[model samples]
Target chain A: MVVMSATTLGTLELAALLTVARLGNDAYGLAVRRDLTERTGRDYSVGAVYTTLQRLEDKGFVTSRASDPLPVRGGRSRRHFTLTGAGAHALREAERHTASIWGGIGTSIRPEPA
Target chain B: MLHVTPRMRDCIGAGARARVTAPRTESPPLPERVLLRLGVDPDFTDAVLGDLAEEYALRALRDGAGTARWWYSREVIRSAPHFLRSSFRYACRYERVRLAAFLGALVLTALAVLITLSARDGPPARLAGASDTVIVNSREPVQLPVQVLDAAGHVLHITGVRYQWVSGAPLHMSAAGRVACEQRGDALVRASFGALRESFLLRCRPIRRFVDWRGGLWLAVGDSAQELPIRAVGVDGTPETMLAGSAIVRDSDIASLRGLRVHPKAPGATLVDVWVGGIVDVIPITVSKRVSTSDALRPFEFFASPLRLSSGQTRRWHIPVGSYFVSFRSDTAASATAAALTLSTVGATCSRFGDAYNYFCLAAKDAALVISAPGGTSGAREFSGYLAVRRN
Candidate 1:
């Protein structure tokens, strides 16, 4: 059977995928939220970060595995997220799509891409 | 190969929520309890709550504990809806078939109970504020049919039963079981509640119809017998209990009548005459091959409620189809002598004897067993009697 590709990503989904990619081996809910907060200057809730990661994982753009729990009081196992090959390809397509959409832009208020 | 850790045995947050010594983090009791109460997936609980606590400690160090708690509460509120949805959706996807099966069973059980009660499929019912008799005098709608029992001999208390007419009558019966007078005729109706049956005579006016004797011609050859169940009905096919009895039949080489049953010795055709309350009828019988069923005798039970008889009053009962010796007796000697109670049946051999109670044993060669109490010189008129039947 022919496969249907994952749909285009929303801003939050795109940002979450990139954060998981950038974090590499260390990516999880808290790390992703901190990274997104630093880059976007918006302190997103961990719930939103986890939710987006879950959605990306659902779309096969990311995968996740639970780690051994931290040996501390009230510490629980962490769910580490990883960017998949589909995620990388989707990111490249999104960049291409955006570049194509902005290619003809020339305005006094906003300059066109170089 | 990867080594399995001790933690790996547990699927996160399952079983117990017991806390152990760990690095100080923000898993405050109230918010954690609230988040847990939101019914998040247990597999996700350890990771989700762990991440929240870790972030809580870090934030509490940078900001104050109060601010961190405020932020923690906000995060819990934000996460609750998503976790709930995901958890529910996960449960639905995984347990879809089982859930469907369970719900189907529940629905079927409820439907069965509903159907049973609506159909009134149980013991007789007592209509609220309704009499034992159903008279269709007016054009009115009813809920269900009523079963009526006669108030003679002994009163029968019944409810939630339906009227079944033995023959057609000049009476209009509604779906709700209300009876209306269609014409000036009487029909006997019977209602059976499994083993217990109650029959009543329906009267519209003066005209009384003859009770129907429901049976077919039967003849059994050599050592074979056939049960002739007599159903007494009214003029238009309703039940008539007054004329329910049988008469004697000749014990011949061809066929013999044993109570209401006929046993044939030889083949060929024969006519058997029966009488009930001065009414005589002859039915033809044809005995072919012997049937498979046996006519072996078994234990029997026969009883009647204590009968109270007035002067010159007579009552009779039909011998049920079987080989049995029936006995009738007055309750006491003084009452029997004063009442002059007599046990007699036409065409059936009977012997009278007994001083303690005016008692007599009647052979069940006949159908109708008549008991009469006549006023005597001793001046006592009314008396009670006990009737019993035993297998012969």
Candidate 2:
């Protein structure tokens, strides 16, 4: 049987995938949110991070497993996420597509820094 | 260790001062309460509250308790809507499946309860017997009354009845069609007639024969065939006094006891005369002395001293309170002298020698026996003796 490729990732899904990739073995709900805030300079809610991660998992872009409960987290387990091959390919494809679209516009526009 | 700069030291001091002055108020466990009130899924609520509390604690340590509380409140409020929305969506997605499962479980529980009630309250059984347990003597047969009835309380006559023993032996129907128990032990008797059947337990107890002393000479009845056993009941069918060491002569022909000696353990004991096998005999002798608590002690060899005693010297040994029969033997150059020794809480002294010495003494608590050689004796003396203490 022929296997169809997974569909394109949404903005939050792509961001979550990249955050999981950057987090390596430490990718989880709170960790990914922290990394997203650090990179994007915007605090993301824990719900958004978890929901996007769950959607990524459904899209086969990421997989998750529960870690043992930690006392610091009030004895709650961490749902750790990992990027799959599809997720990595999607990231690379999104990057290449963005680069191609930017390649056409190149240096023509200058934006003010925050 | 890294050196602390002046600015860092100042900042640390300020932070310490702030901590020292800050009110030691604990953050109420609000996240858990919020999750409970919102009816969030347990799995998600725990992790969410944990993450919030962990971050809150970190911020509290770094910035201040007030800032930490504000941050935590904002995070909780911002995340509440998202979490609620997601949880609602999840519930909606699986609502049908969960409802189906719950309804299935309810149906199964109702079905189980219905079956149980039906089994318990259904029509009354046709055949029923009285007394699930029947106790009878092994030599005697017990008639178990059985009644057959319809659903309405009317008695139905049984055409034919059959009895069978599920356990034990010699369980049969007598010529009159009654159940006969002839052996000792337990038997499950099941009676069946037509389509109706019922079962009951039969415990055949063996007749106990006892031979004990009673007023005069009386035969006692007991529950066992123990030799010299105290009779639980006398020949007059009255409860007999239980005694220890009472002579029990079972299966004795009284007519042949023309020369039998009736020795009472003590005065005031009544000799009960009973007839066994067409012979007048005294089998159960009820003693007047109630068996004392001290009688619980079995006959035991209390003390046996192999040490030799010299003249004018005494050896004392401690013994518990009880009745003891002591026998002493002394060996001198002339002959081995056997002496009866007596010792009690009160005054009692015996120095006689060269005979069977049987002295029964009642020892008070912490009583000791003092064995001494006669002051006039001057030869080498080796003394050895044993005390037979009677136990209740």
Candidate 3:
């Protein structure tokens, strides 16, 4: 465990864990990056995605292992990331926190000035 | 960050981040070196660069090679701040001792600054608005503050000065320079600090409210000068024997002050100012002239003329200031033998007689006298008398 103490996850860290959970066995830095950009409609940098995955791994929310040497990029091992038990709990916590913060806000029209 | 030993890394399985040798190949040399310099984790740096390279190849196939290269460069610059911060974290994880030393130095510098500021006890330039004397009224005691001034002439709250009562009875002050007085007296107060010394006169007086008669003082212009009985009131507001205050007559021509009494010199209007400290009580006196008449013995004016009254009926008179005789006689001689009349002061007897005759020497300034005529049922059916007085 990373320091054996819990670390809080930011938005990007939560999203990376969700992407890793969705990808199942195929989840890696490149696949997570592509999913985040296409789904969020914002191009997240490769560095941003890897930094979040590193943070998630440090929190013990996600664990990473090197895949067999891939044929792409003249034989480089891919760091495939997967959701741990803690990652599933972290995702549920994120959902509840989001709901609590957005619960009482109203979707009403603005009032006219006097 | 995980503090993984080389043995732990080799034996890592599930839940363990398998440390890998990030082979430096196919990644742009300059960008890879820049990522290392910016403090990105070595394995994460490899993963990030490889992902960028893979996306670049795909974008080159879909868009153009020029666009892919430009996009990659833009992405690297946009992501620099995050990479720099991540590198800082990596350095903290590795260099704990160096980081602690830096934080300790920062805290020491802050402590030094605080100590220097607290040690500064600025010297007072002078006393603020020092007056010649401070008067403490017995009613309202004088209140003076020891306000020290800064070099810029601003009044600083009293600090660091020892205020002591050097001499003066019935007056006192606390070490903090608060003054108090109980009775009419004066005190000498001195405050000193370092080489500077300041002194103030603390004078006290008694007299809170008006120190005069209820309706004011009115004394007559007598034939002989009289020592008027004036009242002196204390701070408690009772005008008894409390004579702590001094009374002054404003118009000396009309009335002159002999000790505490006001001796009238002329028939005029004047004011008497009774004061203790600055508090003053005004007494207005009207010394009107006395209406004099002939000194011959005249019949005293009764409420009724001919002095007709039923038996045992009494009458009263407020006699003026004079030496006069109180006498009464029955008009009927038949009833006079059994006739009896009693004339006396309100509380004491002045004169009384039977057999139709009453005479006595009664001298008074301002007094009320009562006289009543009496006849028994067998004596006479009517009883009457005449009362007379002569101004001497």
Score every model by TM-score.
0.36, 0.34, 0.34
Off by over 4 Å in 2: A1-6, A110-114, B1-32, B92-392
For the record, the alpha-carbon RMSD of candidate 2 to the native fold, in angstroms, is 21.1
Output the better candidate (1/3) by lDDT: 3
lDDT of 2 by residue, B127-204 (tens): 666568665532435556666666765566644566766666566655223654444556777877777777887665
Task: Give per-residue CA lDDT, model 3, range B1-392, as digits (tens).
Answer: 45232222332222232122223333342544443444334465556656666666677678877787787677767666555655456543433344446558979999999997775546687764246566444455344655677676666575677677878785556677665555666777777766667887765545555444543444455534545455444555555343344678888877888776777776666788766545666777555444433222233221222455667677766665444444565566665355655666743235443233434445454566666777466544555667654322
What is the DockQ ranking, best to worst?
1, 3, 2
- Strongest candidate by lDDT: 3
- Candidate 3 at A74: error in angstroms? 4.0
Clashes of each: 23, 28, 1
lDDT of 1 by residue, B30-131 (tens): 765755554435555566677778877887889988998898788878777666654554443434344446558979999999996665444333222233
Quickly count the clashes in candidate 2.
28
Lowest lDDT 10-residue stretch of candidate 2 chain B: B13-22
TM-score of chain A of each: 0.84, 0.86, 0.83
Candidate 1 interface CA RMSD, Å: 7.3
User: Could you tell me the TM-score of candidate 3?
Assistant: 0.34
Candidates ranked, most accurate by lDDT first: 3, 1, 2
- DockQ values per model: 0.21, 0.15, 0.17
For each candidate, the alpha-carbon lDDT, in order, equals 0.59, 0.54, 0.61
